[model samples]
Target: MTHATELTVIHVPVSDPRVRPLLQELGDEYSRRYGKDAHGEISRYPDEEFTASHGGVLLLLLEHGEPVAGGAFRRYDATTAELKRIWTHSAHRRRGLARRVVTELEREATARGYRRIHLTTGPRQPEARGLYLATGYTPLFDTEADPETIGPLPFEKHLPATATHRATHRGKAAQP
Candidate 1:
């Protein structure tokens, strides 16, 4: 009998080598689904936009030290984080990795004082839509309408203030 390997999350820069496969596959999937090269969309933002120094983050789920899933979030506003590139390796789907990635991104964003998260999944991606809804995101577009007509389907979740944010609000130093 085979045992399941443990999964671990790690923060990394978008330029990290392990991140390449996820990006490539994600671009390929997007292109295939949208019937156009997704290179531009995938590269729309500068890599620095997903780094900690820029008030953003990129993280990956590693299984046996190889990336199996990953996602990123960048500062969207004074109190919101914009989630991007949430992907689970094609072979690793239906195992809840995408949800795990979203949860991790939320935790990180909360730690950084973001009060909410905003994201948009492509219209062609019903799985992503289901994931967001099942995970408590409020759909910004009408659910009964045709998704293709809606273009990118937007969602948002208001995060509860973490202890750090509360401490900041209270004018006290937060414990590390």
Candidate 2:
């Protein structure tokens, strides 16, 4: 018997067919929330950015072998990873699945020697902002009026040095 508590997350290519519908749903939600222009800017993530060898990853949270939620991250700099596409099925919200995806992605970043994680969520996604803050991420751009960026509130999380090797992507060690 599989309880919802036993949901599994697997890393896959961002373009995997299993995740296509979820992406469409995400697109629809974005258009509904932030209007079309912003949605257009935010759609689509490149595949090479989500493959493992490049220190990028895409994850799908599955139940009974079916995708329920998803997220991804890519090498941002030598020491930083940029998180993206954190989405939960409308039927799956409030289930903690998105949190699990974020936690797993962070672990993957740490495992690969990333020292910090960066991400952004649109103003329409108050829940996402709250999720990040609740999970210890700090907001990066709060008071900038008339921001030039067309999408999302930027957030960052500095990972503790718990791995045998610090991340190589940063080109230099991050100051503690």
Candidate 3:
């Protein structure tokens, strides 16, 4: 087994050859948890949504130089990013990789000038929900529903503005 210390993280295409396995596994698991019919929703994300040039980003975690954990984010609004596709290989669970991914994603968004992030995880993914909560996300809903009964758990977090954010906003003075 490759040690966590040996893992390397890099930004890559959502459809890159090296990152396909992680994305496929994420889709397959979502299919199983939601149903094969849900494949439509799983596959409907536009390609540009994961393209950095389009105000989006995808990150891959490589262990022994192979993709293992991954996640992505896309612009949600002028100042909000939407996080998606967070996953860690089953063998790599409990290793804090997901938290690292979330943290990095937040930093990436902040660097890109986003002031907040919004995301949703299916109710069946309690671990994902916990990861977001543990990483400073606030639930959008008033009540937490059972994983088996709820639709999806929505969460949001406001990123602390970085120099990039401040610089970008410095020009947009409010109209009097």
Candidate 4:
């Protein structure tokens, strides 16, 4: 029999300097793995614009009080949110942390009245692309100008408004 560790999702404010080190680590790893430069360039935007204005939320996946994985979301519009900078430590891969983070972000967005969530993943990152597809995010048509210029494949998931209600109601209906 296998047991899963209890996962806690905490929102880390992006502006918090504590998060800078993690972001730097992730950026370094991402560049090393994909042969792309991301360290000092894209870091400023999230730390400034997205996190500043729209209440960007960074969901950290912690087990036993250690951050093993994390993801961020920024509101794009009333009906849309953008997922960004999702990363799981190499030691924590293949344990479904990425999937859980994405799901948690989607649920959070839905709770905030967003009906759609969007994200972009580079073509070189097959694992990310696979996860997004598996989670029902379809490829988008137009490409937005991003720092990488790596031609990220955009994905969007439109969630039903009633989905949350149904989820909350399942198996706990009034027994009167």
User: Of the candidates shown, which would achieve the greatest TM-score relative to the real structure?
Assistant: 1
Candidate 4: where are CA atoms >4 Å away?
1-5, 46-53, 141-150, 162-176
In candidate 4, the residue pairs with backbone N, CA or C atoms under 3 Å apart (3 or more residues apart, or in different chains) clash, namely none
The order of the candidates by lDDT, greatest first, is 1, 2, 3, 4
Looking at model 4, report the run of 10 residues with the lowest lDDT sum: 167-176
What is the TM-score of each predicted model, taking all chains together? 0.93, 0.84, 0.88, 0.77
Residue 155 lDDT, candidate 2, scale 0-100: 90
Candidate 1 lDDT (Cα, whole model)? 0.89
Model 1: CA > 4 A from native: 1-5, 170-176
The models' CA-based lDDT, in order, is: 0.89, 0.80, 0.79, 0.72
Candidate 4 per-residue C-alpha lDDT over 73-118 given as tens digits, one digit per residue, 9 for 90 to 100: 8767656788888888777789888888898888777676667888
lDDT of 1 by residue, 1-176 (tens): 11235888999998899999999999999999999999789999999989988889999999989899999998887778999999999988888888899999999988888888999999999999999999999999999999989999999999887865796666543221
Task: Tell me the TM-score of model 1.
Answer: 0.93
Tell me the spans in candidate 3 whose CA falls farther than 4 Å from its real position: 1-5, 147-149, 171-176
Backbone clashes counted, model 2: 5
Candidate that would win on lDDT: 1
lDDT of 4 at 145: 42
Error of 3 at 1 (Å): 13
